[model samples]
Target: MATPDLRELYLSLVCLITLVLILVGGVQVVRHGLKLLLPDPPPPVFAPPPEPADSTAMLKPPRSYEQAWQQTERLRLQRQAIRGLLVNLVLLVLAGLIYRAHWRRLQIMRRT
Candidate 1:
Protein backbone atom coordinates (compact mmCIF):
# COMPACT_ATOMS: atom_id res chain seq x y z
CA MET A 1 0.00 0.00 0.00
CA ALA A 2 1.32 3.43 -0.97
CA THR A 3 1.49 6.01 1.80
CA PRO A 4 -0.10 9.40 1.16
CA ASP A 5 2.23 12.39 0.73
CA LEU A 6 1.95 14.90 3.55
CA ARG A 7 2.50 17.99 1.38
CA GLU A 8 -0.17 17.00 -1.12
CA LEU A 9 -2.60 16.24 1.69
CA TYR A 10 -1.99 19.62 3.31
CA LEU A 11 -2.27 21.47 0.01
CA SER A 12 -5.57 19.77 -0.80
CA LEU A 13 -6.88 20.56 2.65
CA VAL A 14 -6.00 24.21 2.24
CA CYS A 15 -7.64 24.39 -1.18
CA LEU A 16 -10.82 22.79 0.12
CA ILE A 17 -10.97 25.21 3.02
CA THR A 18 -10.44 28.19 0.72
CA LEU A 19 -13.18 26.97 -1.62
CA VAL A 20 -15.61 26.64 1.26
CA LEU A 21 -14.82 30.14 2.46
CA ILE A 22 -15.36 31.60 -1.00
CA LEU A 23 -18.73 29.87 -1.25
CA VAL A 24 -19.74 31.27 2.12
CA GLY A 25 -18.75 34.76 1.07
CA GLY A 26 -20.68 34.43 -2.18
CA VAL A 27 -23.78 33.29 -0.31
CA GLN A 28 -23.55 36.23 2.04
CA VAL A 29 -23.26 38.66 -0.87
CA VAL A 30 -26.32 37.12 -2.52
CA ARG A 31 -28.31 37.31 0.69
CA HIS A 32 -27.40 40.94 1.20
CA GLY A 33 -28.36 41.72 -2.37
CA LEU A 34 -31.73 40.10 -1.87
CA LYS A 35 -32.28 42.09 1.29
CA LEU A 36 -31.57 45.31 -0.60
CA LEU A 37 -33.90 44.33 -3.41
CA LEU A 38 -36.79 43.35 -1.12
CA PRO A 39 -37.10 45.51 1.94
CA ASP A 40 -39.63 45.31 4.75
CA PRO A 41 -42.88 47.24 4.64
CA PRO A 42 -42.87 50.72 6.08
CA PRO A 43 -43.77 51.05 9.74
CA PRO A 44 -47.26 52.24 10.67
CA VAL A 45 -47.55 55.86 11.69
CA PHE A 46 -49.99 57.23 14.27
CA ALA A 47 -51.10 60.86 14.54
CA PRO A 48 -50.28 62.62 17.76
CA PRO A 49 -53.16 63.78 19.97
CA PRO A 50 -53.73 67.48 20.76
CA GLU A 51 -51.25 68.85 23.25
CA PRO A 52 -52.59 69.46 26.72
CA ALA A 53 -52.49 73.05 28.07
CA ASP A 54 -50.62 71.87 31.17
CA SER A 55 -47.27 73.68 31.51
CA THR A 56 -45.75 70.47 32.92
CA ALA A 57 -45.91 68.75 29.52
CA MET A 58 -42.41 68.44 28.08
CA LEU A 59 -42.19 68.55 24.29
CA LYS A 60 -39.52 66.46 22.60
CA PRO A 61 -37.89 67.19 19.25
CA PRO A 62 -39.50 65.31 16.34
CA ARG A 63 -37.34 62.88 14.35
CA SER A 64 -37.97 61.62 10.82
CA TYR A 65 -38.84 57.92 10.65
CA GLU A 66 -37.42 57.60 7.12
CA GLN A 67 -34.08 58.86 8.35
CA ALA A 68 -34.08 56.26 11.11
CA TRP A 69 -34.85 53.50 8.62
CA GLN A 70 -32.06 54.63 6.32
CA GLN A 71 -29.59 54.70 9.17
CA THR A 72 -30.62 51.22 10.28
CA GLU A 73 -30.25 49.83 6.74
CA ARG A 74 -26.84 51.46 6.42
CA LEU A 75 -25.70 49.91 9.68
CA ARG A 76 -26.98 46.50 8.64
CA LEU A 77 -24.99 46.60 5.40
CA GLN A 78 -21.88 47.71 7.22
CA ARG A 79 -22.21 44.88 9.70
CA GLN A 80 -22.65 42.34 6.92
CA ALA A 81 -19.53 43.62 5.13
CA ILE A 82 -17.52 43.42 8.33
CA ARG A 83 -18.69 39.86 8.94
CA GLY A 84 -17.64 38.85 5.43
CA LEU A 85 -14.23 40.43 5.90
CA LEU A 86 -13.72 38.59 9.20
CA VAL A 87 -14.61 35.27 7.59
CA ASN A 88 -12.12 35.85 4.78
CA LEU A 89 -9.44 36.81 7.28
CA VAL A 90 -9.99 33.62 9.26
CA LEU A 91 -9.80 31.51 6.11
CA LEU A 92 -6.55 33.20 5.12
CA VAL A 93 -5.11 32.49 8.58
CA LEU A 94 -6.06 28.83 8.33
CA ALA A 95 -4.49 28.56 4.90
CA GLY A 96 -1.33 30.20 6.17
CA LEU A 97 -1.07 27.69 9.04
CA ILE A 98 -1.52 24.77 6.69
CA TYR A 99 1.09 26.14 4.31
CA ARG A 100 3.55 26.57 7.18
CA ALA A 101 3.01 22.96 8.26
CA HIS A 102 3.53 21.74 4.70
CA TRP A 103 6.75 23.77 4.41
CA ARG A 104 8.08 22.35 7.67
CA ARG A 105 7.33 18.82 6.49
CA LEU A 106 9.23 19.49 3.26
CA GLN A 107 12.20 20.87 5.19
CA ILE A 108 12.30 17.79 7.42
CA MET A 109 12.07 15.46 4.44
CA ARG A 110 14.90 17.32 2.72
CA ARG A 111 17.12 17.04 5.83
CA THR A 112 16.73 13.24 5.94
Candidate 2:
Protein backbone atom coordinates (compact mmCIF):
# COMPACT_ATOMS: atom_id res chain seq x y z
CA MET A 1 0.00 0.00 0.00
CA ALA A 2 1.11 3.56 -0.68
CA THR A 3 1.17 6.42 1.82
CA PRO A 4 -1.42 9.14 1.20
CA ASP A 5 -0.34 12.69 0.40
CA LEU A 6 -1.21 14.99 3.30
CA ARG A 7 -1.32 18.03 1.03
CA GLU A 8 -3.89 16.36 -1.23
CA LEU A 9 -5.95 15.33 1.79
CA TYR A 10 -5.91 18.86 3.11
CA LEU A 11 -6.98 20.26 -0.24
CA SER A 12 -9.83 17.75 -0.45
CA LEU A 13 -11.07 18.75 3.00
CA VAL A 14 -11.06 22.41 1.98
CA CYS A 15 -12.92 21.54 -1.22
CA LEU A 16 -15.52 19.63 0.78
CA ILE A 17 -16.07 22.57 3.09
CA THR A 18 -16.43 24.88 0.10
CA LEU A 19 -18.97 22.47 -1.38
CA VAL A 20 -20.99 22.56 1.84
CA LEU A 21 -21.03 26.36 1.77
CA ILE A 22 -22.20 26.29 -1.83
CA LEU A 23 -24.94 23.80 -0.99
CA VAL A 24 -26.22 25.90 1.90
CA GLY A 25 -26.20 29.02 -0.28
CA GLY A 26 -27.94 27.07 -3.06
CA VAL A 27 -30.69 25.89 -0.70
CA GLN A 28 -31.36 29.46 0.38
CA VAL A 29 -31.52 30.47 -3.26
CA VAL A 30 -33.99 27.71 -4.04
CA ARG A 31 -36.12 28.61 -1.03
CA HIS A 32 -36.34 32.18 -2.25
CA GLY A 33 -37.00 30.97 -5.77
CA LEU A 34 -39.94 28.91 -4.57
CA LYS A 35 -41.32 31.83 -2.61
CA LEU A 36 -41.05 33.93 -5.74
CA LEU A 37 -42.75 31.29 -7.89
CA LEU A 38 -45.59 30.28 -5.60
CA PRO A 39 -48.33 32.38 -4.12
CA ASP A 40 -48.36 32.31 -0.33
CA PRO A 41 -50.68 29.77 1.18
CA PRO A 42 -53.92 31.39 2.30
CA PRO A 43 -54.15 31.81 6.07
CA PRO A 44 -55.92 28.91 7.77
CA VAL A 45 -59.44 28.60 6.36
CA PHE A 46 -60.86 28.25 9.85
CA ALA A 47 -59.57 31.26 11.73
CA PRO A 48 -59.43 30.06 15.31
CA PRO A 49 -57.95 32.57 17.73
CA PRO A 50 -55.47 31.20 20.25
CA GLU A 51 -57.32 30.22 23.40
CA PRO A 52 -56.03 30.68 26.92
CA ALA A 53 -55.91 27.33 28.65
CA ASP A 54 -58.01 26.90 31.75
CA SER A 55 -56.17 27.31 35.09
CA THR A 56 -57.73 24.00 36.08
CA ALA A 57 -55.37 22.37 33.58
CA MET A 58 -51.69 22.19 34.44
CA LEU A 59 -50.19 25.64 33.81
CA LYS A 60 -46.95 25.45 31.90
CA PRO A 61 -44.74 28.10 30.28
CA PRO A 62 -45.14 28.09 26.51
CA ARG A 63 -41.63 29.35 25.81
CA SER A 64 -39.18 26.85 24.41
CA TYR A 65 -35.90 26.33 26.22
CA GLU A 66 -32.56 24.72 25.48
CA GLN A 67 -30.32 23.12 28.07
CA ALA A 68 -27.15 25.06 28.94
CA TRP A 69 -25.00 22.26 27.53
CA GLN A 70 -26.94 22.25 24.27
CA GLN A 71 -26.50 25.97 23.78
CA THR A 72 -22.83 25.66 24.61
CA GLU A 73 -22.42 22.87 22.13
CA ARG A 74 -24.11 24.95 19.40
CA LEU A 75 -21.84 27.90 20.16
CA ARG A 76 -18.83 25.64 20.09
CA LEU A 77 -19.81 24.25 16.72
CA GLN A 78 -20.42 27.73 15.33
CA ARG A 79 -17.05 28.87 16.57
CA GLN A 80 -15.35 25.83 15.06
CA ALA A 81 -17.06 26.33 11.70
CA ILE A 82 -16.22 30.02 11.55
CA ARG A 83 -12.62 29.27 12.43
CA GLY A 84 -12.46 26.54 9.81
CA LEU A 85 -13.81 28.87 7.11
CA LEU A 86 -11.35 31.59 8.00
CA VAL A 87 -8.46 29.16 7.99
CA ASN A 88 -9.56 27.59 4.73
CA LEU A 89 -9.84 30.98 3.03
CA VAL A 90 -6.38 31.92 4.23
CA LEU A 91 -5.01 28.59 3.00
CA LEU A 92 -6.63 29.12 -0.40
CA VAL A 93 -5.19 32.58 -0.82
CA LEU A 94 -1.80 31.45 0.39
CA ALA A 95 -1.86 28.48 -1.97
CA GLY A 96 -2.76 30.75 -4.89
CA LEU A 97 0.15 33.03 -4.07
CA ILE A 98 2.56 30.14 -3.73
CA TYR A 99 1.48 28.74 -7.09
CA ARG A 100 1.86 32.09 -8.81
CA ALA A 101 5.22 32.70 -7.19
CA HIS A 102 6.51 29.27 -8.16
CA TRP A 103 5.22 29.66 -11.69
CA ARG A 104 7.08 32.96 -12.04
CA ARG A 105 10.20 31.37 -10.61
CA LEU A 106 9.96 28.56 -13.09
CA GLN A 107 9.59 31.05 -15.94
CA ILE A 108 12.64 32.96 -14.71
CA MET A 109 14.63 29.76 -14.37
CA ARG A 110 13.74 28.79 -17.93
CA ARG A 111 14.84 32.20 -19.19
CA THR A 112 18.25 31.86 -17.45
Candidate 3:
Protein backbone atom coordinates (compact mmCIF):
# COMPACT_ATOMS: atom_id res chain seq x y z
CA MET A 1 0.00 0.00 0.00
CA ALA A 2 1.24 3.51 -0.88
CA THR A 3 1.51 6.18 1.80
CA PRO A 4 -0.73 9.24 1.37
CA ASP A 5 1.05 12.43 0.31
CA LEU A 6 1.03 15.59 2.45
CA ARG A 7 -1.40 17.35 0.10
CA GLU A 8 -3.78 14.39 0.19
CA LEU A 9 -3.61 14.23 3.98
CA TYR A 10 -4.20 17.95 4.31
CA LEU A 11 -7.17 17.90 1.97
CA SER A 12 -8.68 14.92 3.74
CA LEU A 13 -8.27 16.62 7.12
CA VAL A 14 -9.90 19.80 5.89
CA CYS A 15 -12.79 17.88 4.33
CA LEU A 16 -13.37 16.05 7.59
CA ILE A 17 -13.27 19.25 9.61
CA THR A 18 -15.63 21.01 7.25
CA LEU A 19 -18.03 18.08 7.31
CA VAL A 20 -18.20 18.27 11.08
CA LEU A 21 -18.72 22.01 10.97
CA ILE A 22 -21.47 21.60 8.36
CA LEU A 23 -23.32 19.11 10.50
CA VAL A 24 -23.11 21.29 13.57
CA GLY A 25 -24.15 24.38 11.66
CA GLY A 26 -27.08 22.54 10.07
CA VAL A 27 -28.35 21.41 13.46
CA GLN A 28 -28.09 24.92 14.85
CA VAL A 29 -29.92 26.34 11.82
CA VAL A 30 -32.76 23.89 12.33
CA ARG A 31 -33.01 24.69 16.01
CA HIS A 32 -33.11 28.43 15.42
CA GLY A 33 -35.51 28.06 12.50
CA LEU A 34 -37.90 26.10 14.70
CA LYS A 35 -37.65 28.70 17.44
CA LEU A 36 -38.41 31.43 14.92
CA LEU A 37 -41.34 29.51 13.50
CA LEU A 38 -42.90 28.26 16.72
CA PRO A 39 -41.75 30.36 19.59
CA ASP A 40 -43.05 29.54 23.04
CA PRO A 41 -45.47 32.03 24.55
CA PRO A 42 -44.05 34.24 27.24
CA PRO A 43 -45.30 33.53 30.72
CA PRO A 44 -47.89 35.92 32.11
CA VAL A 45 -46.69 38.59 34.55
CA PHE A 46 -48.43 38.32 37.90
CA ALA A 47 -46.77 41.38 39.45
CA PRO A 48 -48.86 44.13 41.02
CA PRO A 49 -49.79 47.19 39.00
CA PRO A 50 -47.76 50.37 39.12
CA GLU A 51 -48.59 53.04 41.71
CA PRO A 52 -51.04 55.69 40.60
CA ALA A 53 -49.47 59.06 39.70
CA ASP A 54 -50.81 62.36 41.15
CA SER A 55 -50.78 63.92 37.68
CA THR A 56 -54.14 64.56 35.97
CA ALA A 57 -52.85 62.74 32.89
CA MET A 58 -54.53 59.42 32.31
CA LEU A 59 -52.43 56.41 33.22
CA LYS A 60 -52.26 53.37 30.95
CA PRO A 61 -54.15 50.32 32.15
CA PRO A 62 -52.21 47.52 33.79
CA ARG A 63 -53.38 45.06 31.15
CA SER A 64 -52.13 47.36 28.41
CA TYR A 65 -48.73 47.48 30.02
CA GLU A 66 -48.62 43.72 30.31
CA GLN A 67 -49.59 43.38 26.68
CA ALA A 68 -46.89 45.81 25.66
CA TRP A 69 -44.33 43.86 27.62
CA GLN A 70 -45.36 40.66 25.97
CA GLN A 71 -45.15 42.25 22.54
CA THR A 72 -41.69 43.59 23.22
CA GLU A 73 -40.52 40.25 24.54
CA ARG A 74 -41.84 38.48 21.49
CA LEU A 75 -40.12 40.93 19.18
CA ARG A 76 -36.83 40.49 21.03
CA LEU A 77 -37.08 36.72 20.81
CA GLN A 78 -37.88 36.94 17.11
CA ARG A 79 -34.85 39.09 16.46
CA GLN A 80 -32.64 36.66 18.35
CA ALA A 81 -34.01 33.69 16.48
CA ILE A 82 -33.53 35.44 13.14
CA ARG A 83 -29.96 36.37 13.99
CA GLY A 84 -29.12 32.86 15.10
CA LEU A 85 -30.67 31.34 12.02
CA LEU A 86 -28.78 33.64 9.69
CA VAL A 87 -25.48 33.02 11.42
CA ASN A 88 -25.92 29.29 11.36
CA LEU A 89 -27.02 29.32 7.75
CA VAL A 90 -23.90 31.21 6.79
CA LEU A 91 -21.77 28.73 8.68
CA LEU A 92 -23.44 25.77 7.06
CA VAL A 93 -23.06 27.14 3.56
CA LEU A 94 -19.44 28.06 4.01
CA ALA A 95 -18.58 24.72 5.53
CA GLY A 96 -20.39 22.84 2.81
CA LEU A 97 -18.56 24.79 0.11
CA ILE A 98 -15.25 24.21 1.76
CA TYR A 99 -15.91 20.53 2.16
CA ARG A 100 -16.92 20.23 -1.45
CA ALA A 101 -13.88 22.03 -2.71
CA HIS A 102 -11.51 20.01 -0.59
CA TRP A 103 -13.18 16.72 -1.41
CA ARG A 104 -12.90 17.51 -5.11
CA ARG A 105 -9.27 18.38 -4.77
CA LEU A 106 -8.59 15.20 -2.88
CA GLN A 107 -10.35 13.15 -5.53
CA ILE A 108 -8.36 14.83 -8.28
CA MET A 109 -5.16 14.14 -6.41
CA ARG A 110 -6.05 10.50 -6.05
CA ARG A 111 -6.88 10.26 -9.73
CA THR A 112 -3.56 11.78 -10.71
- Predicted structure with the largest TM-score when compared to the true one: 3
lDDT tens readout by residue for model 1, 33-111: 5655664544444445547776323443245755686677677766665675566556556656665665666567555
Taking the candidates one at a time, how many backbone clashes does each contain?
0, 0, 0
Ranking by lDDT: 3, 1, 2
Query: lDDT values of the candidates?
Result: 0.60, 0.50, 0.88
Cα error, residue 42 of model 1, in Å, equals 15
The sequence of per-residue lDDT tens digits that candidate 2 reaches over residues 10-111 is 555555565565555555545544544553433223223445766523343332323444556556655555555555555555555555555555455445
Select the stronger candidate by TM-score from 1 and 2: 1
Work out the TM-score per prediction: 0.45, 0.39, 0.83
Off by over 4 Å in 1: 1-63
Per-residue lDDT of model 3, residues 7-96, tens digit only: 999999999999899989989999999999899897787664546676323444477888998999999999999999999999998999
Question: Which portions of model 3 miss their true places by more than 4 Å?
Answer: 48-61
Better of 1 and 3 by TM-score: 3
Residue 33 miss distance in model 3 (angstroms): 1.2
Q: After superposition, how far is residue 46 of candidate 2 from its true place, in Å?
A: 40
